[model samples]
Target: MKITGYRCLTTQHDWGRPVGDVNGHVDSGITEVPILVLETDAGIEGVATGSTHDVDRLFPAIEGEDPRAVASLYDRMIARVFKSGHAGATFGGIGTIDAALWDIKAKLAGEPLWRLLGARDRYVDGYASGLDIALDDERLAALYGSMAERGYTSGKLKGGRDVADDVRRLRIVEEALHRNAEHPGLMLDANESWHRKQAVRHVSAIERELDLVWIEEPLRRWDAAGHAALSRAVRASVATGENLTGLEQYRPLMDAGAVDVVQIGAVWGVTHFLRVAVAAHARDLPVSLVGHTADAAVVHAAAAVPNTMPTEVQDLGSPIGVTIDQAFQDGGIVLGDEPGAGIRIDESEIAARMAGDGWRSAAGPHVRSHRTGLRLATERTA
Candidate 1:
């Protein structure tokens, strides 16, 4: 089927999820953000959203291309654009297109995306992220407990502000998850909140006490050497690369022995993530998906890849207006036979949430006092 057109809809909200808190960096002030739908002359449609990829610039390149040839089309688009002037240009743009194209292709084939990707495993483990430092102890308990109730036995909390606070929250999370599993898988994200010495000292202190599944972005994303040093210093596995743009960008961290689990996410879509996933498989390392706003959604990429560890489902318990046709049970999320990512969103509810009272970024850790909201858009994902 030939591509016909596309649409972009976005709105702002008053909720935010941080990488870490109090000390961690990378604060974002986004909310609900935007969702894209690529329409085809054949009546197939694809949905996507993530990162600030220049989607506007991409439409012309793939306007008439075969959506079924997603990989080739993606590669062609990359070759056509010799250089990405901005940081997320390559990943944000390419990945979203790839996702939308995959949606169209999967619809044309009358199969779910996982079926095309391989369907080797029908389920991937999920973990609750976003125990933000900004939240009080009561909110923290509610969020984590809410997550566990949704059948998630594993969870990760934002750490790296204060040793005492981290320790205290870890216990709180442990209490929550233990309600289900005798031994729950726990993780942490410091979001480069600490200096090298501070990170080492902090992780070391936690290592002496807690059993963490992994520590995410423990240092600045660019700190390959520091990540390596911290990886060696900590007992927990290190997962990085969410901030890094592409495979070439991630290779250095892999080579430096900095990341135990390579994370591939929104910026690069399924095609790029598959490249990294295949490479990680060859290296015998685990690959994880970083969290995203649509309930930490892992759109069309999970089922067929190798060396994939438990992926993220950040807002599983939050009343985010987006959802998918999947079941969360047995500590894993199961995909439905729906074409594409199977995402369902309520634009009106999201607009209400965004227009409510405060303004906050959905992806990163930033909040502002903005009073106005984006003009709402009509819902379109089928």
Candidate 2:
């Protein structure tokens, strides 16, 4: 079957609280870059892309490609636009298409993406990603207490600004976990806010306090050497790569042996991220899907990867995940035997919420924002 058409949807929400991290806090409501729908000729359509900015520009390249030729289409799109610096958006745009194509292919073949990706297991373990930076130790303890009840034996805390304050927060979470007799594993994400010296020092101090599963993006994204050095200095594993664009950029970090865990995102779409996972597996490294605040797609991708370590379930923002038709059980997610990515979009709901807003360009064909969101649609579309 061949591609038919595509649409982009962007939605905005007023956040109830500030989503804080080392980068500062977002007090306003959050915006969602949800992927809409892609139509195909085989009488099958699916939502493979989740909340992205430029779903419109991705249509042309994929409008006529065969659904089964996902890898070829992916390579062509990457090679065609490789020199234009459109890697991020191109990857994002094509990712939706590739996912849809995979959905169609899998449906035709009567299999799930994971089975098609050759995984023997459908259930993968996950960790709760707590987002209660504004809460005091008592409240934070209560929050973590809830996580333990949910069956998550692992979790990650957002850190960066105040080292002492973060240390206290970690203590609270640890105490709560132990109080419940859960012995849940703990991890921290600095979001590239700390310097090498600060990260090394802070990680060392907290290492003995909490059994840190890993430390994510403790320093800037480009500091491969620093990360390598820091990895060598600390007992806790270093994890990164949520922001790195493509395989070329990822190669250096992997080659340097800088990170013990690689974080891939579905925002780059499912296909590209899978390729990265394969590369990581080749190096005998573990990977975790970065929490982009979207659900199912990344969770499914992580499940499909043979070397996946832990999937992330964020605590902040929307009630969408909790309201999904499927259930997240036993500290893991199972993509219940649905064809394609197995996510059904509530089109009427999405359109009404995103009414009066569609694809609009402030710059050139390769430069546009699908709506008010900051997602850069940088691909030249015919």
Candidate 3:
């Protein structure tokens, strides 16, 4: 079916609560952006992109293209903007449009996007990603101690500041899990806050304290050579690429032998993720899907790839996967047999939240953190 129209819906929601780590106090907050929806002639509409900027500019690029030509359309968009940088807000815009096109195509074909992507299996495994980065020692241990009871055998912790303090935090988490015989696998994310030397020093200490499965983006997103050197120096497997856009950006990391695990976001759309997956598979690298708080779309994409290791289940503010209509069993997430992405947005709830004055009232003062240089500013409600 042909494309009919596209619309942008901007709304706000509390993303997550704060958790403590070794570095200091850390919390999660909400930022507002437009979610793109694509409508087709066959009376099928799909949620294309979630929380993206520049919806106005992306509308004209794929307005009349066939929904099934998602890959070709993605190529066209990339070629049209090839001269532009592949990271940051511009690539994020193109990613939104590409995702919408896939949603429309899968809905039209009357099959789940995973089936369309040639997935041999229907379900994939997942890991529990906690949000207790701000808790003290006692509270942090209790938080992870409870997570083991809930059947999460793998977990990720946040780090970026003091090396010794971070090691203490990890020691507590490991001891709590070890007491129960759960022996949960652990991963760490630096969020691109450290330099090469600092990452090496801190991650080496972490490896000694905890049996880390992987260390994610300890340096910067663009540090291919440094990642390679660090991978050689540390025992923890190097994992990165969550902030990356396309296959071209991914190639250098692979060629450099930098990353041991590749993390991809489905919000970039099915076609682009699949392209990256195929390349990663060629190099025998394992893949982990990154969550943008909401990740049902990526759940299906991750299951289809044979080399996919585990999907990251973030314990953030609101439970998007649990609240939505899709089926989540055990620690793994499963998509419905419905066509397209197999999920629907609750438009009434979205509208009500948008119309209310809650978000405007919740907008707090902006505070910048010294460690990550991230400004935790309250976004204006529109």
Candidate 4:
């Protein structure tokens, strides 16, 4: 079927609790969710989560092409944005269309995306990530305890501030996960808030008291040398690359041996994740799928890969107006027999909530504080 046109919809993910990391948070615990719908001439439509800055500029690349030609269309879109650079929102835009194209391809084949991609089982292993830096101690325990009850044997906490507090909070997560497994895996995300020596010192102190599986984004995402140094200095594996937009961005880190666990963000679409996973596997490295806010479509791609460790489970529910054909059980995500990526959107529900619920704060988690790396630098020298 040939691609026709597309439309965008607005929705929101209500966490019902605060969600943030070292940067900051929305006190209301709500954020906007953008959905893209690709209309095809063969009476089939494909849906994807997240949006790019400009649809007009990118749509022409795939306008009359076959949606089933996903890889070629994806490459064409990248080339379309070559001079301007497809980083940030533009890459996300390319990714949004690419994800929708994959959905269409799978649906045309009359099989779930995972099955079409040759996965033996529909189950993808998962770990809980609360984005809980803004949450208090009582709430933290409650959230993780609930996830443990859902059979999650691993959990990642948000922390990069004080060593004493980080240690204390990590134990809380460990205790929560201990309810499910004897040696539950625990991870920490510094969110690119620490410098080299600072990340080493902080993570080293926590390692003395706890057995960490990994420490994520300890330094900046592009700091190949710093990440490699941190990887050698600490017992926990260094995991990063959730913020990177393309394959080229990951080459430096891979060459430097900086990342022990390669991470692919769900928002970057299926093609990018699959390519990156294969690249990481070629070098004998394990890859992990990072979840986006209320989006888990990439789990299908993750299941098709052999070296996938555990995909992140950021939320138990989906955004308003969205329904996913998957269930979380046995400490993993089980994809249903849905013919596509398993996401269905209700336009009426989104239209009703579009007016008031989807607003984001200007100073949200995406913005880093001026004192983020500076405070740790001062401490390291002192």
TM-score against native, each model: 0.85, 0.84, 0.84, 0.97
Residue-level lDDT of model 4, residues 104-190, one tens digit each, is 999999999999888999999999999898888889999999889889999999988888888888888989989889999999998
Please report the TM-score between candidate 3 and the true structure.
0.84
True-vs-predicted CA distance for residue 322, candidate 3, Å: 10
RMSD of each: 7.9, 7.8, 5.6, 2.4
Off by over 4 Å in 1: 11-30, 292-299, 317-323, 344-382
lDDT-based ranking:
4, 1, 3, 2
The window of 10 residues in a row where model 1 has the poorest summed lDDT is 372-381
Off by over 4 Å in 3: 13-16, 19-34, 83-86, 138-146, 175-181, 316-325, 354-382
Per-structure clash totals for the candidates: 5, 7, 9, 0
Tens digit of lDDT per residue, candidate 2, span 161-209? 5556666777777766664446767788877767788788778878756
lDDT tens digits, residue span 1-382, model 3: 6777877766554544443333333344343435677787877786754545655555566677677887777777666665754456666667777776766777777788777767777776777666555566776777667655655567787765665666777777676666445676788877776778777877887777777888987877788999999999999899999878778889999999999999887556666677788899999998888763454565677878778888777653332212332544455565567776665565566666653332222322122235442323211211
Candidate 3 or 1, higher lDDT? 1
lDDT of 1 at 31: 42
Better of 2 and 4 by TM-score: 4
| Candidate 2, RMSD to the unseen true structure | 7.8
Q: List candidate 2 stretches off by more than 4 Å.
A: 12-17, 54-56, 179-182, 315-325, 354-382
lDDT of each: 0.69, 0.66, 0.67, 0.88
